[model samples]
Target chain A: MIEGRRAALPPVARLGDAALRLVGEAGAMFLFFLEAFGRIFRSWGQFHKTVRQIYFIGVKSISVITLISLFTGMVIGLQMYYALAKFGADGFLGAAVSLSLVRELGPVLTAIMITGRAGSSMTAEIGVMRISEQVDALRVMDINPLGFLVSPKLAASIICFPILTAFFDLVGMLGGYLTGVLLLGGNSGVYWYRVSAYLKMSDISGGFIKSLVFGVVVCTICCYMGYFTHMRRDSVGPEAVSQATTSAVVTSCVLILLSDYILTSLLF
Target chain B: MQANTPPDIILEGLTIGYGEHAVVSGIDAVLPGGKISVILGGSGCGKSTLVKHILKLHPVLAGRIVVGGHDIDTLDRRGMHCLRQRMGVLFQDGALLGSLTLGDNVALPLREHTRLPEKDIRERVLSKLGLVGLADFYDYYPNELSGGMRKRAGLARGMVMDPQLLFCDEPTSGLDPVTAAELDQLLLELKKSFEMTMVVVSHDLDSMRAIADHVLVLGAGRVLFQGGLAELEATQDEYLRRFLDRKAQERSTPRLTMPPLDQKMMKRDCGKYLDE
Candidate 1:
């Protein structure tokens, strides 16, 4: 009888229902993020947990971030050198590579990389804790699970994202120098001059702002996915954790790009 | 920091389930203070659901639950936390944090709730672990411990706060007989030593017989019996008799009604791989 009723519903109704659910989930996610973020200052003791998370989410991610950033910079340098060489404006290679990295690729790629590396783990760890009842144990012990588990991650992400973006931008400029000046035999002085002269405080600050927003977006979506793993209707237990982790990574990456566009439009 | 007597839990017309669908309803019972009240049932009879409702892990679906004279529903967030500080729960399979050592896991409650020095916290943690015979394995992670040890560690963490009320969900569900019996003994020891109100949710008849001071038997979404353990054991109700005696109900139909699978439908057949 229930199946028949559900089947009898019109496609438009079904679509509306799905749309409503999406809106509801967005509202809930916002509230969840607010509660967790607000609790970052709930206690002096949370300082230690935040620092530990920084070691895990920030310091541990440094090596991967470095590797990816260097390669990303190198690729940009090579591409820009060739593109500028066609127009005999290869002197602008540094400006092209540095601006693109700082304004776009640096924040976007760094976020995507961290989402794969750290954000996915955040989801899995919390999802496991959720399924295993460790989160409930915290609540029963009079400890808020949000304050204990997620606020630290959020704090660490906010701190790490911009710093990592800055690092990526700098390394990418050097990569441009490696290709444009050394490999392709362009004048090093002109390339360096273009990079320093074209880059402005507004561009740097805009990129910083983008990274910060991406940090909140990634952390919020990933943590929310894990925290609600048990409540997922499609699966249960370990499979649910896996699904949540996948969803966290996918959602964080998508949102990073989506928010990057929105922030770019607004900031620039 | 122990209460002179752990407070009684009062459940009035309580209905519990995941959502609108009710698993158990109209449950009215008073779990007395300073006694081990075991909630007995068959598998999936909403024993754990009731316990979760009482713990405020899930919202009360329909009725009122009063813990120590305070209606749990009326308590604000701060009030709820204050109420929860007086209670502890041991989940099935321990639920110890994977990231922390057993010692740190046990010390979590104290470190979060109290301003005690590290030395005092360590001393208290060691004492609790000692009570559970896990003092020597303080540095071990939860995965490194056996099932019984993890449960014992969970118990130690539950007790570290010296909570007035402790809830243990299936403390003896998945354990060897010897280990199960040892846990039962530990519960008895804790009851005798601390005099805290302990609500144990389990289907293990032996564990109930060994440790239950008061018994509440739930079946078919209602409280079938609520009283002394002897009274429950003495009851002659048909369902109760079948449950207590571990007798299977006589079925009117054959247990297996489905036809066997057709081997000819297989996408890949390799009859030579097996001896028919």
Candidate 2:
């Protein structure tokens, strides 16, 4: 019994150390977020740089967003059509598909996709810059590293995430129509009419709000991870950057899912 | 401009390290104007940490750092920025922004800090690059250049604003002998031509011998020795002796044995000196 208890429970000092580390990490993340946002109004001089980031994060993500959303919508429509067909409620297919895409899948999938696509890359790029001492070089130059390096990324993500989510919603709706009305021999008029009837402004607005918050969360976490990753003495070389990138992606994804549940509960 | 001027940097009772772990402490020294002061140490002896304290990269746990007559700990944000404007740092790896071309990298400070026109900025960039022997390589990327070329480019970037004080971290660590000597000559020329005060952190004895006017040796979180190279060479300090004569193999003879000094003869007459 004693051995089991020992195995189950770590030492009190180790637990305290872990708790303290978590608190420190939280404090650092909060300060970094505050600093990044604090510089927004003052970073107008970096307008061109922010634009470039938007292009890189938003514009470059269009094709993948479209492809993923369309396929997701088609799968949802086909499944819902067959499921509703059992009850002679085939006309409800559009409402089901559209609601699922806009209310939950659109924003969440967009965020996860971006976490995989751009967020991990941001972490790796900044991690490389950090280990290479380019970040210190900026500090030496009398430039606020947060303002010069991170704020642009934050602003770009916040502006792009909502737009990308909107694109995902639009393409998803179209894909639902293709699968439900044309392919499955459902009445086109009834399908779209039910979709238009059931989908409210609240649903769309909730998705947009979630996308914006997710954008902030993902970018802030990724940026913090990359900026503060002190390469360990034993774990030198390119693996450090890879480790940070993986951590950023995983943390962003888990936070997105957790926050999604909270937002859904509140918004509903 | 540096002639007969006060020291460019002063540290008093300084301690540096991360939280709760002091790497180097009790560092009281002055880097005089228009001279190259070398901070020399074996690896992991807090040389870079001391330099960082002067650069204001991190907080000093105890003591004060005065740069150009301004106390660093007391500087507000704007004051810190102004102080930084007067100094330049050449990192060990050059630390050029990989995304920008060499010309753009050199012109980064002026573009960010000054309101110079495109034409003037271009001219200055070219001139600085020319000084560093990277005139034709302005359009090249950092990855395209060799290590020595990158260091020179970083030097050009450092000199773009005509800084009064410069800090170089391990400027000769990974260069060939000829290239290292050339860099030393270039540093000598810059010191002469611009009258810049330079604080160089190095372990390379050859580079230190070539350029150092003052040497501060650090070890075990303290200043082991601080003086001219000749004075260091003349010292009998065992650690300094071992470091200076590092290339020699271990002696087969067990160790030196010396006769003990007479206690009465070695004792200082503090009473007489104090009374006098």
Candidate 3:
């Protein structure tokens, strides 16, 4: 009985030590952004390579970006036509599709998809690095973890979001055009003219600004989730990665949608 | 960037962690120039954390880390980067970037720190890779290499900068005994050739015995033992004794995790063939 108790004691002691290490891991989480920024600027060659990585993480993510944005435009076009036609203002289809896709759906949906595809990969990549001690290795070499790991992703999001939004704008309008004029027989010329004319400066500008903010939000949340994944590495399972993917997408969606409303009201 | 200091690396009550709590604390160490010291411990004993504080990877929690006569905690980003150009590190499991080729990985620090022409960088890469016995494998991707080769490739990358201070974390974990021995010999050769002050963190007893001029044994955030191999062999501490004994067991043990009888029989008759 005494030997049994002695054997149990060491394991309990190990648990306590593990718990303390978990706390240390959590403490490292908040330093993610600062660390990445420091690493990027510290090495000029790393900075150049970072630019290349950002291109891959962002520009390479464009095909999915295009697909999701186009579908969203189609969905919203159908939804708006129901209410607009109920009020007997069918001609506003052009105005509706353009305004909706440019100011709201284009940026928001594009951001959501990017978060799901690229953001999760970022989190998993960083999370694996965190668990595997790649981050710790960087520190020992006097290389900052954030500069090499997190900064390139953040910078990539910044560059990609706007161009992706532009793509979202073009494709979503095409989706809207297909759904509105081609499907519904709402004159194409009238639809194009109204969209172009009705879209105020802020509408396009608001969409652009939202893309930038969404970029930060997506990268921040993804990096944050991955950066602090030490707690759930073993128990977190594939479900955790999926959940992280979901949370990132959902958070960026909520932020983009809510902020679109706020920015629209403020800018207009 | 390094000033004239007797010891190239110094830590005084160096405390570091996330916030409030200290992961590695009360560390007072001085690494002299031109010798190899191994920070010996098992996983999560704060050995890695201790090395981070010395490198000033994060803000010091409550102590001082003076490297080459300059206080590391006081240095800003650019200042730290400048100081870092003087140090090289070989990370465990070879954290060579998967996106880069072996030659490119070796050339990374040089390309980042200097404006040397492409030819000069390539020449330097070849030299470093050659030193690590990877002369013919420069263009290979990290995925193509074996585990031991990857570690050597990482060592080549670390050496490309010709750093005065070199740090290697867990240099021999998960390697075959012969490979680990070869690596230990290479590290000794590198130190003598370059006059480098090398700090190696490992739980490998064979490696510590083979390469260390001094050993700083750590357990939980305090120094358990600090001395040369001869002194370590003569110590009466039970914790150190059990620790070193386990390492010797690991070395002689077979790759399969079953009992020794199975390993012996398998080696003698090649089990499947014997059964047939």
TM-scores, all candidates, are 0.95, 0.90, 0.78
DockQ comparisons of all candidates to the true complex: 0.86, 0.63, 0.31
Off by over 4 Å in 3: A1-54, A76-88, A140-145, A228-246, B1-30, B41-44, B58-65, B74-79, B236-276
lDDT per residue for candidate 2 within A21-125, as digits (tens), equals 679887888899999988876845778888999998999999999999999999888898999999999999889988998889999999999999999988988
List model 1 lDDT by residue over A1-268, tens digit each: 4447656889998788779989999999999999999999999888999899889888898888888888887888888888888998888987898889989999999899889989999999999999998998898898899999999999999999998889888887887787778888989899888988999899999999999999999999999999999988778999999999999999888888889889999998
Candidate 1 CAPRI-style tier: high
Query: For candidate 2 chain A, which ten residues in a row score worst on lDDT?
Result: A228-237
**Comparing candidate 2 with candidate 3, which one achieves the higher TM-score?**
2
Error at A257, model 3, angstroms: 2.4
Against the hidden true structure, what lDDT does model 1 obtain?
Answer: 0.91
To one decimal place, how large is model 2's interface RMSD in Å?
Answer: 0.6
Model 2: CAPRI class: medium
Give candidate 3's whole-model lDDT. Answer: 0.77
Off by over 4 Å in 1: A1-8, B1-3, B256-276
Of all true interface contacts, what fraction is found in model 3?
0.41
Compose the digit string of candidate 3's lDDT tens values, residues A1-268: 4335545777778688678866774465436655665555564556675677667667787788778777877776777666677898767887988887888777877787787778878887777677656666566555556676778777778788888888988888888778877887777887788888899987888888888888877787788777666655334745565565566567656766787778778865
